[model samples]
Target: MNDEPKSISIKDIAEALNISIGTVDRALHGRRGVSEKTKTRVLKTAEQMGYKPNLAAQALKLNRRISIGVVLPKHISYFFDPLRAGIRAAAGAAMGSQISLEFHEYPRIGSGDIEALEAAHARKYDGLIFLPGDIQRFSPLIRKISRSGTPMMCVGSDAPDTGRIGSVSAHAYISGSIAAELLAHKLPRKANVAILTGELSTLDHAEKLSGFAATLAIQAPHLTLMPTLEGHEKPKEAYRQALTLMRQKDRPEGLYLSTANSIAVIEALEELGLLGKVQVVATDLFQDLATLIKSNKILATLYQRPFTQGKVAFENLVAYLTRGNLESPVVQLAPHIVLRSNLPLFASRISETDEGEPESDSLE
Candidate 1:
């Protein structure tokens, strides 16, 4: 009574097409030494036969396991925690395959980062995903790695001039422009604005500041720009600098936080009783920041979608290694503006705790 056709196999495909099994295998798996005409014929024949690859069997056939390395800074736990979770989730989904991930965390983006990169290079991983701290400082190392023919994907920031294979991140420049637009609309005509950013050595922070400044210059020419304060991504230092800035005779009327230290800045404002006096536009999302947004202490924030960035960075490297499909050199995801009206939607998505994992659902 059973009339369904039997499953197709490589041997079945080869016999049906009057070709050798080895030739069929090479063509199907996209291996070298197979002619174009022969590959076309073999693929067409396999398709006609309703063939499907047995992934378990394919895994067994693979003799070597693919290895990938991820290097990131540990100081910025708020951002890197979700990023690591995303990579882990992706690795779990790919458990069936023989892919292993090695994570390397550094204290900051200087000597420690360089050491991690060198160690990963020495280990000879099939692919690497990293948060490049300073393009100029790391470009030499990156160039050396590229010369060895190992694929590298920059996650968070980019080093275009250094010959990186690709990069996955939110558009930092656009995020800054959005902040500028929001502040320009909220503040007075001649309001003084100051920027608090991480080190300018990093490209992402630099790009964000540049975009914000450029937009303000064009859109709100009357608003005066103040000297930037480098927080160095330290909360205590940021708090101190913010306090000093707020106590000045002609303190800034608007503050643009280009980093993820909004809490420190807000605390300083609250201490100075300037929380409601100054307009604030910040980057990234956190529980406290969301609360402030709801209470009107902070105006809005641009969500960077760090989870998606991490997930895509790992997936792209795996795809390049297994299928020879190279991703675009620069994959920039658009930033989402979260205001009081739509804060609830994003609040549900952001992690409640600092080390908590992000939601499994894909970001919009």
Candidate 2:
């Protein structure tokens, strides 16, 4: 009686193809109960008639909804905000279609963090997105997620051993290397440079430092880089620590920071009235810092694509769910360079040369 061609139903297909309902059902499930010839004939006819399964109706009949879980730290990260916006946009686009999404925030990986992660992951979500804070300590948690048979994506960090289904992380070593190379090009030949950072593990602090050092060796051999100062990735705390370094008499001409709490450091520079005295470069972008770049309070920043990450992660999950490609490939979306000259083209171009290619420093 109902004539809605928009809805593809099993009953509709069976009736149109003049097949018994039982035969169609068995063909749909690939049941061993049906004869091989009947199964092939029924499926061929269904395909020829443009038969399509309704995920929503199927889920209702089977009593299982496609669910996805996302985990993130609750700290005030300027990058995460935009990333969240992208994630919501991507998920909302898929709403009332196939999947349901849930978001969980844990401020840090503390005493009960593992328990919390486990509990949230225990839900029968089809997939997961995680910002893994500390990989070494969180290895067990990662393993647990892997064993749960749900595809997992690691954003901001690469968790290779944990069976991460995909990753969308910045090329940290290359970002830091670019800062060093660019600073050399912009500054005086003998100028001294210094670096400030958060904990080395979380921000890929060590890898960035390696890039900076390597780039410095080839492009600005005469330049000097002071010892790295740990800033704890907090604005006020980093500002306080930076005060001592900023006041030093033969202060470095370039200040490099690969940090999570860069706002305070920039403010500290302003307070010292040394805003333009030292060129500064950092790892991520913020609204205020982009303003500073236009005003020349900061020199350059290597921008990572968090928004693209959310989109890619969701796509990975969707592919795994509908297609049954359970072991989804690990994908790393490239990073971007954000300078005052070009904030508009944030994630357009490739940030660095691929790691596989043999590259030697060139002073251009």
Regions of candidate 2 where Cα sits further than 4 Å from its true position = 1-63, 108-116, 324-328, 344-364
- Candidate 2, residue 10: how far the Cα is off, in Å: 26
Model 2 lowest lDDT segment of ten: 353-362
Candidate 2 whole-model C-alpha lDDT, 0 to 1: 0.68
What overall lDDT goes with each candidate model?
A: 0.80, 0.68
- What lDDT tens digits, residue by residue, belong to model 1 across residues 13-120? 888888898899899989998999999999999899887664433543575577789998886666777877778778778745588889998886664899999998
Residue-level lDDT of model 2, residues 1-364, one tens digit each, is 3122232346666777687777778788887677888788778877877665544335535756677788776564565655565566678776455577887876543334466567778786767777766567776677767655666777666666665555666667787788898799788579889888876655356668888988998888988988888765556768887888888887788988886468788788889899867889877766677677778778888766666666666766665555434343555444466787786654332222111111122111
Q: How high is the lDDT of residue 30 in model 2?
A: 82
RMSD of each: 9.8, 11.6
* Highest TM-score model number: 1
